[model samples]
Target: HSSMGEVWDEEMSSSMLGSRLRKVVQNYQAMNKYNVENTGPGGVASRPKLSGSELLCRLKSQVQVLTLTPDLQPFASLSWSSQLPVKSVTSELGPYKSCAVVSSAGSLRNSGLGKEIDSHDAVLRFNTAPTSGYEKDVGSKTTIRLINSQVMASDEHRFLSSSLYSNGVLVGWDPAPFSANLSQASWYNRTDYPIFTQYQRYRRLHPLQPFYILHPRFEWQLWQQIQDNMVEPIQKNPPSSGMLGTVVMMSLCEVVHVYEFLPSRRKTELCHYYQRFYDAACTLGAYHPLLYEKNLVKRMNQGTDQEIFTHGRVTLPGFSALNC
Candidate 1:
């Protein structure tokens, strides 16, 4: 079972937890520093850092065409019977002028960003992060909810029953082998979590809800771009859901404002705004290539770092507007 019991030892005293937490942060910082210093001469200069223009050009060339939703025929091979194919998300929420990608980072706490977040034309939030009680921190508006396969498979009850998911556009993704090419057969067999059955079930129950599986290739393409552009080589893992959602919005909208994806002045170890639990890995990343993702975002960010620090906001020009 997916449990954080070992990761978060509840028996530890609060004072002890805080003391140990400092060491963990120190170790992570050292490791990250080593990774950067050992990479090449003069750190960032050793590897070619993509300028804003270059980064935008690469994103336009490599990532913009990759779609988050699968094609119609992908479901044909599966035994699941459906009279209608899964609807295209773009068809439902097409051509937004401005959008916001709201991250679940704890740095978002007390930033008073709710009104600004809700002001966008569309807002995208990650898996299982609630907006009920924390409306002041995280806006009540959710135009799109992006989830991973774990949420679809393990939390089927909530996913199927919750009114939270029923209101917004739902897009879920599962990781395939890093090099796996896009095909219904390969994707079905190689995915860490096979969500086809669950997806079919959800669609059948809520025919009106726009739920789509993000194409596995789209994820890998972004991963490749991240690796290619970063100063230091990143882990071979997939990009975080936050990064994926940002690119998704960038492709669909004209201007995308990403909130707290990169920790700002109010940065905290708290994993999410909804929970009191803290994990440095949430920001630094354990499984996903989040550190590199943050660097990439910072490189591409049009706004000043001061703005990012105080407001926890980064403004980006959409991929559609990039002149490749």
Candidate 2:
């Protein structure tokens, strides 16, 4: 078995809830471990890869905005509808020579990648990872902000009132129970949180800002694709917002320059660069299917291991220009 598999084996043995379940999961992983070679293409589109047009269609179709319910219920005090953004986001900021995806990982702490990262045509950051004081490391440019519903529903002071989220194109997603019934009514009834209500309120506060909630189907489709490609069956969770954001940028740019998604030799236990908390799970992942996701990313990356280890940067051809 490979080092990552070995590590996962050890981790799961101790952390998994029950013995029978752990054995079943491990057995499934072992079956797929050598089903395909590590050097082959990541499970993205099979060996030959999708043509640019097909790939474009697939990605574009998946990127959609969830329709919000007309009536504000439960959280009736907030003016949700009027506060929403002017319209759904319809950006085509792509076909560029290069772009950057700056992860919030603590591995980025002293990379001095600000100038290189800022030089890209566009940059994407996640959640509430700030660039104000950490500009020397993470850069100050913000072309996009991809957040989860937790970021939207929980922190009104930071997400709603702060000027930090005011500048960039905002995309948020809340998990839904079923992919088939992701309508406004379904979303109203089954959302993990009342993010739609909060979204409306935030929109009322900043109508001019471009804000869009991701279609629940798009998230599930992405998760499904990731699972189909993985050697091991992944946890039944959606891909992390970071992975989704990377795909979004790929569709919009010519070349996606990803930083710290694969971590570096300077990899630390810290969860995010802006915070001081520590956990190896932040890099290897516990809640997310992150280990499998990283495996796919490392396989698809056009850059070398030296670059990833030293600079924490990985280069990938954008989906807009991809032939496979």
Candidate 3:
């Protein structure tokens, strides 16, 4: 798409270039293991993977994280109405730079619910009580599946059902085979995430008899976020000129995003930043509701085209404005 009379032609940066920005595969290089930390007072997500005392002992150069520990309970049972709760988290080793802050309990095995909730916590808590400086956890996924049954390990997998009660129970899932209950706004449980679709497709190839199916229990709680959270932050809004125009925000998934300024000085500058942000989003694999908004370029000044916070792909009942 053309913006500010200029054309954006660059493509999304691949892992080859992104590798330098991130810690790489994390394993390909020496794993920068941090210390294990215990949950503070209040309900917390379980860290069965990392030992608390051991967690406290792994700090390398220094990385401070905000953790949620059960004050009276063992595991934090977040519900639909529950909002993210965090306070006094920032006083770390120094001024925070650009980086994704991870949860102390992130276990690769339980990637589904563990980091998901933490990501939600990152956004929810950041909006209210920001812990570290800079956008800490915008790359997080705001939803999670809760398992409270004793079925097979795979049985505990969470799938999006077709229908649901007010309490958020999965009655069924599909195109309704007639009409769809879900919309294109947000990504739902189906073929992509949680890896259930792959098994389902393969299983159908062999079955004619009753097949063993593992079911999951409990509803997922959506994370709270600003109504116009999709609206990218316009750094150096106006007045000042140059190539510093930028858009930045922390996504519900706890990822830090930066869309460089679209210089609209002439249509050329405007188009430049447009492609930079757009291409940057694409380059960064920003497919979520965050930077994935349609062409939301609006003219703020001569060289700056502003993208007012617009709509997102997903919408909940009470929070119609909250984007996916």
Candidate 4:
């Protein structure tokens, strides 16, 4: 069985991350803030290694892309019953032939991929990554925008009034306690942010827009799949918005092209193309299990590494494309 250090070494081989970033990863692993417990031998060590195709099948069978249905709790018992959309996200906006998941990575700043990104049948972008000035690189189309609860709750983001959010089908997600039951009470009591209140307010303001909260169980289930596939435990925190957005697109589109989620040769210290913030953690991961998430996506990539290096792109077949 591979040790945690050994697995990190493997990542370092390709990432060429500096010692400081390496230390940050080790710190998060040691913290395991959410208290994930994986006491058995690692899944990869316990079973024969599965081919990428088998891994894709496993993901198709195991991970479910679910959104808050009106019938589910909290929202069901509350006034949200009438506000929530009757159709699932997939049913409402899906079955596209091709889609793009554009990460906010700084590497995209001058890649000149805007035209290509906009060509997809649909485009999925994360949080407040604007497509205004950067349309030369990041494209100007947004069919879906998957946001973290923090974004919905923050006054700084102008979640209720920002034109940035007014476009696209908005989906919100929050990290609940790792062990909490998927009940109305449990979820309301322990969400990482006060997203419920903001969500309700937004619904009242934009009664016509299609906005849905992602089922909390979806995040943890995807986290479990990530942990199960690896040789060592990742951070107990939830997957990044980028990873969750990728899976959501996978469920809705026939083929998903993810951009900059995997760093290209143009990788830089800038956290996002839109902001002046600079943090390697945004790419390598400090809070979210971003490194493991990237590795997992790389494993499932049907595209060539040259694409990853050149376009910062990774192509993944959507769940519907998988026979399993």
Candidate 5:
């Protein structure tokens, strides 16, 4: 039987909780930063992840071949499910022109990044993981990250952690292709974050895209098709006529100004309180995009005495992007 009192386990539950919370915060911050930069018309995007019967229509519509020459299949098949044979991401429709087949250089850099953050283990790993910038330059590269890895007493509390940008652009968390189930999956969408206000607004407004994207000049026609068929149907649906849901729509005019005011680079800050929104997300464990999902409006409308993670930003050396 469990009691309100602590049941002694050898495990450091609170410490682990703190560490996990930190991870959630850092990832949320990086992803939030990514949303701002990578989004917009004519920008790098996830391959065509059409869903439902529409996906079948798309499959029938086109056929293009992408060669598997240098071999990324073994790495790609990292997240296969027990029921499904082939790997599938809900939104990773591929065959795009701009994917960078990153080499072991990024992987090695990420591994060493782990070392740089852990102060106790920093010296040990620093000796082993050489910071070889010129392993092979496929032109300039960059990685933006938030790193919150420091040793401190229980009495100390920190809300914001460092945001790491190397060379010029924000560093991506050079993820291992198949290594999906680790910390990335752990914090799926816990509402412990303080950022629910932004999410709540997002849900109420329910924009067609995560952050409303600018239309691409080239693909404007096709883009409208996808947007009208897939996006608007879901996003524009008025909250089903029922009890007034907990979520309230953010003023559309305001959101439009916020999204449209972005600079031509399409890589500027996405929101007025972008930093705070992410800070709340990190403080709580809102790891998956779904935490900001509108479906949970009824559930998260009310508050919970939840836990939170601290934001961490760490600059990992050895890479930079050309544009950023």
Candidate 6:
């Protein structure tokens, strides 16, 4: 098993990325798409670093896994307010003894982790990743599916007609401005993706499905924790859905075992297990601070390096399990 630094740095280094991907990471860094303004003390190098346990405690105390509610604006006055799930995500689908967070990484292709993933009381899958054919590799059970706004807003995904999304509880999120102020008019006016219309449309069709939109603050707060723990500035974009979903599970479950969110020895350039596409950016960071996010997860891992190598798994105690 490789050290965390060896695996992450080797894959994330400029020398490892092809020229095209190198340029893409640089371009996103320059874009600062979310208008992120770093107000924290310099970086990890500038301060005494917190141990993994301390970091975990801080996260348990500070990060709030919140979803949009009737109290929030736009939703408050809009027709969709009543449609929003009345229960918190934790109260609605949580407090599980064991939960699994399944990543779409290509490294999962031949790992044959399906049964183990399904063993969890609840399983969370991201975006449009499927399990029909690859059930041996990825579990067939999906208790919750977390989607980005792009999946809902883009017709290319066939969001309205797809059966993949219909089986599980659905949670959607969009990258809001860095301020993360839901009360501001600017936030609703300029979301990264115009998903509100599509979200409402889906609600009308499946009135009984438990669908929820994550509050924008959840992403920015999680992003700040990632930034605060790093030595260098990460990409200005919000954390990826993998990172967001991991935290969401952390909040709801007693234990979270995240599979392949960090690459295993089986790591490959193939983006998703079900897709033939290849891109290092999908594993590392291009638009999202994936590398940094992975590093933070590594720090908080309760599992051993051998587990990471063999199973591509990192086990974490949920907030309820933490003493803090």
Which residue pairs overlap in candidate 1's backbone? Answer: none
Residue runs of model 3 more than 4 Å from their true location after superposition: 1-89, 93-287, 292-324
| TM-scores of all predicted structures | 0.81, 0.76, 0.18, 0.91, 0.16, 0.94
The candidate maximizing TM-score is 6
> Which scores better on lDDT, 1 or 4?
4
Candidate 2: list runs displaced more than 4 Å: 1-95, 178-180
For model 5, what is the C-alpha lDDT against the true structure?
0.20
Reference-based TM-score, model 4: 0.91
Write model 3 residue lDDT over 1-114, tens digit each, in one string: 443333221211123335543333223213212111221211222423222222212211121222222221211342311111222112211121222222121111112222
Q: Per lDDT, what order, best first?
A: 6, 4, 1, 2, 5, 3
lDDT of 1 at 180: 41
- The prediction achieving the highest lDDT against the true structure is 6
**Model 6, residue 314: what's the lDDT?**
93
| Cα lDDT tens digits for candidate 2, 133-242 | 99989999998888888888776537888887897778888766434354445555667777777787787788777776665666666665556554345655666877
Superposition error at 279 for model 1 (Å): 0.5
lDDT of each: 0.72, 0.67, 0.20, 0.83, 0.20, 0.85
Clashes of each: 0, 7, 42, 0, 26, 0
Q: List model 5 lDDT by residue over 7-102, tens digit each.
A: 112111112345655565345534432112212322123445334334323322321111111123332443321112122211222121121211
Question: What is candidate 1's local distance difference test score?
Answer: 0.72
Q: What residue pairs clash in candidate 4, if any at all?
A: none
Cα RMSD for predicted model 6? 2.5
Can you give the lDDT of residue 191 in candidate 3? 18
